[model samples]
Structures are given as C-alpha cells and as structure tokens.
Target: MWVRGVEWLAAAAADPRACTGDWDHGKGIALLEAGRLWDVLSVPDRLGLLTLDLLWRPGMSVPGPTLIDTAAGRVGFFLPPDPSAGWKGADLRYATKGAWVAVPPPYRPARFLEWLVPPDGTGTLHSPGALAGALRQADGALAVLAPLCGR
Candidate 1:
C-alpha cells in the first residue's frame, strides 16, 4: 500500500503543472515538481520539533520574531506577545530574505514540543509534557514513512 502511494506521489511530482487549486500554487507546486513533497512535509516537522525542544529547556529565553521569505515582501512571526502566554504566544510572519523585522519584547517561544508531545499526563498534540517520548515515536514513524515516501 505504501509503495503504491510513493509511486503515485512520484508521478505527481513528475508533472506538477497538472496541479491546480488553491492548495497547489507557487512554491508548493515547485516542490512537487522537484519530488520533494515528503521532505517538504517531514523536514519542517523535524525542525519545528527540534526548535520546540530547544525553546522548552530550562534557562532558554524566547526567540525573536521570525521572517519567512516570500516573493511579495517580508513578514514577521513573533513567538509571544508577552511572557504570560507561556509557550503559546508565538506568531509566524512571512517576508523576503535580508529583511529586518522588529521583535517585540517578552516574546513567547514555540510550543512544538508541547503540541507534539503533551503534558497533564493526558497526551494531546497541543500538550508539552510528553514531548520527549512523542519525539521518539515520531522519529520511528518518520523512519518507516521515509521509505514509503521515497525519501
């Protein structure tokens, strides 16, 4: 079943021009053309999870707003509006490379770990306490999915 899915994805990547819809445009289509859909999905998850862990550790301060480059212009994403939001205060901004965006003070860090793992002993993707274990499981799942995705 997985092999078949990979074959289908490969075929889709081979001719992304056929993709037309709100969800398929610009870089998204280009990624398909490059046969990078799997990587596109997985790499960000890995990076986001790692970044979350880094942010969650003790003594870690909130990161400034992030700029994600786009053809239009620079947009800023901030981690937190204030310290009270805990780890849920992050915001994402889009923008072009080399643009400088102002980061407000008391920014919140990402809660990827919390989301992926979970706290409260009751686990949900939105919780943080289970991050380490969730990450381990995610790694295993990714390993299995990688081959199926042709990664």
Candidate 2:
C-alpha cells in the first residue's frame, strides 16, 4: 500500500478512534493498494485497509518505516498519552494469555465508553462480564485466523 504523505498516512494509519478525527463528518482519504487508487471515507474505512496489511492479512511484512504524524501532532509508541497507550505500539505481548487481538490505542476510559454507549445513548456502560465476553470472542476469532496472522 502507498499513501500521499505524512498527514494522509497518519489519518490512514492511526488507530481509528485514537486519532480523534470527526469521521462522522465525512472526511475523505485517498489511498493506493496493489497499484489501484481509492478514496476511502473516514478513519474506520482506512483502518480496515491497514487491518488487512497489519492484522489478519497473510504475508510476511516487508520492513518499512513505522512512524506517522497525527492530528494530535507527531506521536509514536514511546510518547503514550497515557498508560493505556500500550496498544499503540507494534507488539501484543501485553495482551493476556497471548491471545492476540488488535487493541486500538483508545481502548481505555475516555474512548471505551464511546464504543459501548454511543454519545447520544443512555449513560449506562457495559458490565465487566460484557467486556470480557467480547474479548473472548475476539481471541477465539484470532485463534481460528492464526494462519492468516503470519506469526
């Protein structure tokens, strides 16, 4: 995959919710894959592309540059905004049971609730059991897709 420049790649590469872009407002990102061009909408849309390359897609990763500039300014694994920034890096060793999953950088308190109760929803949040159950499902999916993980 190839992108235009730092700003474009940052919006396309940063974890969907972590970059804090108002994707709902209809921002467009241009990208190229397999020599074809695409105008992707929203960070989540770009995330899906990156997910194939970085997460579940099968193929040995060719060495490439890792840093990307973001709307929050330039950032990398070492400058975690908080403790939960662990997922912002390239390793899954922090995940429990070695059951790898893509834990996006904003998976902590602030954005965690957004994933649960939408901004306009009732003030309630999902219970701990709900969170754990979801993780279990994800880990199970990862196990089934391990061959595609290129581990």
Candidate 3:
C-alpha cells in the first residue's frame, strides 16, 4: 500500500514510467520536469536552513515538502507552479518550465537527495509569496550575521 501511494505521488513527474522504471531498476532517483505540477525553489543550505527555522517558528505554520542536496550544499522547496514569479538571489536557483529536478521515492532513503520534509501525497505546495518573504528575511538575517561570524 505504501509503495502504491508513493507511486501515486510519483505521478507528478512528467514521465511517471521513467521515474518508476528507474526506481524499479534500483537507480533510486529520477529526473522530473518542473512547472507542470509544481516548481522548485533552491537556495544555499545555510540560507535554506535559516528560512526553514523562521517558517516553523513558534506561531508560524510548517512549510511544505523540502529536499536537501547535501553534496551540493543546497536545499530545494517544492512550491506551486509560478513561471513568472521572478525569484532572484545571489545563490538561488528556481526550476520553472523547461527545467528538471531529480527526485527520490517519497518513502525511500536517498544518498544525496534526502528530503528534509517529505511530501504527504496531498499535492500541497509552498506559497510563493510566503516563501519569498521568508527567504528575504532569512537572507537579511544572514547578511547581518555574516560580518559578526567573519564570513
């Protein structure tokens, strides 16, 4: 049942078979296009962590699914499709239309693409406005601390 549910979640991929085929073949990960079911907002691990902290603080709501690429020192947040969002940052990358994101089975443990906050198969995604606001706050906090930390 869990496998079936995970497969259903995987259907968000542009090519569901390719994703399941790779998993069935033991590849453990597959590439899925963005801007169809959702988009991906990627930021450096440091800033991402800070943003997450702020998002989940005492009175704040928890964010949607999030992934971390430890090997690349980056983190990705799953957000609703917004091709014209125009998100910009010094070390940020937004995967919109025509871009791809490597995703792992929702329940499986991955090497480098582990999920910090796994999806619940509800198709819930982060709000672009809330995320942008949190990101800006996190970035500003980082800038303020960078000098003190000698960065």
Instruction: Report the C-alpha displacement of residue 62, candidate 3, in angstroms.
Output: 3.0
2 versus 3: better TM-score goes to: 3
Q: Per-residue lDDT of 117-138 in model 3, one digit per residue for the tens?
A: 7777667778888888999999
Tens digit per residue, CA lDDT, model 2, 35-118: 011111112222322332342225643212222223322211111012232232222222222122221222222221111111
Q: Against the hidden reference, what TM-scores do the models get?
A: 0.22, 0.25, 0.89
Which residue segments of model 3 deviate by more than 4 Å?
A: 1-5
State the local distance difference test value for candidate 1. Answer: 0.30
Can you write out model 1's per-residue Cα lDDT over 53-122, one digit (the tens) per residue? Answer: 5544677443322222233232222221122222221232222222222211111112111113211111
User: Clash number for every model?
Assistant: 19, 0, 0
Determine which window of 10 residues in candidate 3 has minimal summed lDDT: 1-10
Candidate 3 CA-lDDT value: 0.82
Which one is best on lDDT?
Answer: 3
Whole-model lDDT per candidate: 0.30, 0.26, 0.82
Off by over 4 Å in 1: 1-43, 46-129
Q: Which stretches of candidate 2 lie over 4 Å from their true place?
A: 1-117
